[model samples]
Target: MGTKRLKKQWLLHAVGGLLMTGLGLSLFGEALIKKWENAPLWDWLLWGTLALLVFNAGVSLVGQAVVFRVKLDGRNEK
Candidate 1:
């Protein structure tokens, strides 16, 4: 029950993080290097977004792992 929910959450969180970072990098493409000089705001925005996504993904992974470990340990020992 809760284990399944955690698993789903983990998947979504990880996928979301990958998508965010990938999308930003893809959009930047060859012009990414120029962002530093022409548009510092956009550069910062992209970096901040990626950082948030990564942090969320990491938290989700840890949470899911803990939930799963508890559930597994609680099972009948006989």
Candidate 2:
């Protein structure tokens, strides 16, 4: 992908990850404090989903950074 597209994609992923993480934390916290008997399963599911989103976001950002850095390094070497 082009640099701009890649950057946009990274931004989207990062934002989505942050939003999901926040929602998951809020839900999980509410469930814990409220002592809902049926919440345990849903809590675990939300956490797992949040973890995946954050992981994917982190990997995408890191990958883009490394690619950009390599490009810059190559340009400087020439």
Candidate 3:
């Protein structure tokens, strides 16, 4: 198995992504709940699209964190 290496910046991306994901989900749930309250179609469309965009951005960030570059064993060794 290969060793795993991570950078501090990546941690920020991961944490931010998690927060964004949670926020997006909350927004989405709120939007859904609005249906029972008879919210306007425009309101639903706005919030729903915003929620999806945020969720997708979060997922993209998380994917970026996972795709970071790393060096394998050998050349750098003394």
Candidate 4:
């Protein structure tokens, strides 16, 4: 059913977002601990990429939550 498919998609997005957040945090922590002051361009690039990943994950999670909530509210109203 459509509801089942929606649930599956939401679950997938939630899981993917969590994974990306975890990975981004780990990378960020490692970079901080290693003191990236004198790190090469590649290291900075990696950090920037991780930061972007975290930001993107957060956005995706929030977007999914909003969509799910709207769908749930609509169903309840019907």
What TM-score fits each model? 0.47, 0.50, 0.76, 0.64
lDDT string for model 3 (1-78, tens) is 233444554566788888888889988998898776889988887888889999988898777666542322232353
Off by over 4 Å in 4: 36-38, 41-45
Give the Å shift of residue 55 in candidate 2. Answer: 1.0
Stretches off by above 4 angstroms in model 2 are: 1-39
lDDT (Cα atoms) of all candidates against the true structure: 0.57, 0.59, 0.73, 0.71
Candidate 3, residue 47: lDDT: 87
- The RMSD of every model to the true structure, in order and in angstroms, is 5.2, 5.0, 5.1, 2.7
Which model is ahead, 1 or 3, in terms of TM-score? Answer: 3
Order of candidate numbers by lDDT, starting with the best: 3, 4, 2, 1
Give the alpha carbon lDDT tens digit for every residue of 1-78 in model 1: 665665565566556656655655554452455465576766756755665665566556556556655654565332
Supply candidate 1's per-residue lDDT for 67.
60
Poorest 10 consecutive residues of model 1 by lDDT?
Answer: 25-34
Candidate rank order under TM-score:
3, 4, 2, 1
Q: What lDDT score goes with residue 22 in model 2?
A: 64
Candidate 4 is scored at a TM of 0.64
Model 2: per-residue Cα lDDT over 1-78, one tens digit each: 555665566566556556655665565565555445555776756655655665565556556656665665565578
How many clashes would you count in candidate 1?
0
User: What's the alpha carbon RMSD for model 2?
Assistant: 5.0
Off by over 4 Å in 1: 1-39, 76-78
Task: For candidate 4, give the lDDT.
Answer: 0.71
